[model samples]
Target: MNPLRLSPSRVNDYLNCPQLYKYRAIDLLPEEISLDAERGTLVHTILERLFDAPAPTRTPELAFALLPTSWEEQLIARPGLREKVQNDKEWIDRVRALLTTYFTLESPATFEPTEREVHVEVNLTESIYLHGYIDRLDIAPSGEVRIVDYKTGKSPKPGWEEKALFQLWIYAFIYWRTMGVLPKLLQLIYLGNGELLRNAPTEADLLRTEKKLISIAEEIVYSIENVSWRPRPSRLCDWCSFKNICPAFAK
Candidate 1:
């Protein structure tokens, strides 16, 4: 059998609902792309491009200027995406607001990212391989590493912060396993509400994350072999594109 490749988002899909995973990963169904998600992609592209300029020139105005070109690049990559949006002007305005919020949180001119959209992959076993893209990776002067991810959505409610950090932990795990160094910090920058959520991960924390992933991978293999993709009903189901075909919700 081919190696089972898992990304953080794909792992989240299986954990959310195995049936949803089947539709996305196994069946390879196309999802209805949301305007909000597209806006987030545009903002991420602008931020990544912002660092290409000289550090002193990486200002909010420069970021704003890159918007048109960044958006044009997106349009070229995803043809017909513009027609899906109800109002292109209003949509661009919202994206601009997100970039504005990003500046208030962090001055791009202050620090240079060691890597942007860095892809890391590790083989856990002969058959299971884990992989993901780190939004930003910074190495401090003292050699401490920091992993930063951008979230275009609001910060999660107080009690749900750990769940929100799960994605970052996976990245930290991959970094640590591959680089042999634990990241000193894992940060989530929420542009929607201009909130910064940070976590200092310990070696033990990453170990637990690795174990959790292995367990999930094992369950995934069993589900595939047994042909038993079970639907997990939750409030998140409302936003799922495959709800109509899900056995748990079938009429």
Candidate 2:
């Protein structure tokens, strides 16, 4: 009867650095929510309102203006990012344009929605874990569902598909189990570039995902018993926020 539901993000932490995961999750370090995370929240809020609001009420241009300048401005605080965000003004504009495009690309005939925030608490055999709302969910006339996740970040690569894309699979399974209908699309809409990545999971696809999830969970649980771990050093060390305290990066 454990009320714990796991998400891909928690797994990502263990994958990134187990020691860091221990400090944050077990020791309960004071959480430092990043500016990027905050911006993501804001973007999610705006999109949810736009998509879930009545069809007549949706306005992409309005959401663009609605984004708080303070939150957008605060992205300056990240190291080596003040100039990067500032330089990305054009990029932001392009992203805004893409949002508008989504509205046009999906409105007037797209499934009527009010952008309602949908959160699901799955018992999972009385293990009460929660999954947050998808950025947008469109239920088409054919009873097929589409789960959209908004990503403003730049594309990680041409090889992201094979390299353990746990999140999308999690969402796909969640949608399938929660809603009886099959998903027509599980999409990552890169708001910045209007790029879309999608997958429709088969039984085999999901079985592989389940295996991967279980493997990562086992690693995380094993790391919890001890504390002798350190940062992953290499080029990524230069960018890790934990470098200030990481043994591997000790100068």
Q: What is the TM-score of each candidate against the true structure?
A: 0.97, 0.75
Clashes per candidate (backbone, < 3 Å): 0, 6
Name the runs in model 1 displaced over 4 angstroms.
none
Model 2 segments beyond 4 Å from truth?
A: 1-5, 31-33, 68-109, 114-116, 121-130, 228-230, 234-239
Highest TM-score scorer:
1
Q: For each candidate in the order shown, give its overall lDDT on alpha carbons.
A: 0.92, 0.59
Report the C-alpha lDDT of model 2 over 102-144, residue by residue, as the tens digit. 5643552345742345664343334335365556677776777
53 in model 1: Cα distance from truth in Å?
0.9
In model 2, the number of clashes is 6
Report RMSD (Å) for each prediction in the order shown: 1.1, 4.6
Residue 152 of model 2 has an lDDT of 59
| Residue lDDT tens for model 1, 1-251 | 78888999999999889999999999999887767778989999999999999999988899989999898888889877878888878988898899999999998888989999999999977889999999999999899999999999999998999899999999999999989999999999999999999999999999999999989999999999999999999998988888888899879
